[model samples]
Target: MLPRFLERLRQQADNLAGLLGNRVALFGIELQEESERLLGHLALLLGAAICTLFCLLSAVVAGLVLAARYGVLLEVCATLAVLFLLLALGLAWYLRRRLADAPEPFEATRQEFERDRLALNGARETAQ
Candidate 1:
């Protein structure tokens, strides 16, 4: 009887360990997914920034060449430069606002943690 009881206890310990391992694996998977998503967004933003920079540079060069060919180069270039500067500032401000409005990442994980805490507190209260 003692040996059988010891075997059963060992079996239960192994099962508990397995359960914990599975939970850890699942948590790791969730973290990986979130990290991948963040990286993807970062990559896209970087690509967009590179493209916009190229476009802005092209536009400025084109504007300056046209102004030099058709009008007073210095005055036209100054005006174009100021216009582009203002446009860049406006876009930066808009991006700031948009970023502020963006949702928090890993919100689901936070909510799940809160729910678990509440449930544990409720269980503790019931026990008391």
Candidate 2:
């Protein structure tokens, strides 16, 4: 009877391990897909922003030249626009770096919880 019970327990342990393994694989796939989507979005937005910035900068330079020729005062505006855009880009880069440093969601925590629970149960069984 004890041998049969031990065999059944081993089977259950194997099943539990299989379930956790599947969960981990699924979570990894989900994480990979999310990361890819976020990176793709960032890439596209960065590309569009860079293109728009180049166009705006060209326009500003042209305007500055035209203003100088016509004796107007838009050099200050052009300078301010460039400065503000650079400041915004710097802030965005800083934010992206900070977000990248954040930990993955609940993965380590889940593993720890599983370990703790298994240990507690084993202890309880031994005590009994």
Instruction: Please give the CA lDDT of all the candidate structures.
Output: 0.75, 0.74
Give the C-alpha lDDT of model 2.
Answer: 0.74
What lDDT tens digits, residue by residue, belong to model 2 across residues 47-94?
A: 867986797778777777777788775765757678768867975897
Tell how far residue 11 is off in model 1, in angstroms: 13
Worst 10 residues of 2 by lDDT: 104-113
118: Cα error in model 2, Å: 14
Give the clash count for each candidate. Answer: 0, 0
Which pairs of residues collide in candidate 1?
Answer: none
lDDT of 1 by residue, 43-122 (tens): 86687678878887898888878887988789877887787788778767866776677666656556656775687589
RMSD (CA, Å), each prediction:
4.5, 4.8
Best by lDDT: 1
For every model shown, what is its TM-score relative to the native structure?
Answer: 0.61, 0.59
**Model 1 lDDT at residue 40:** 71
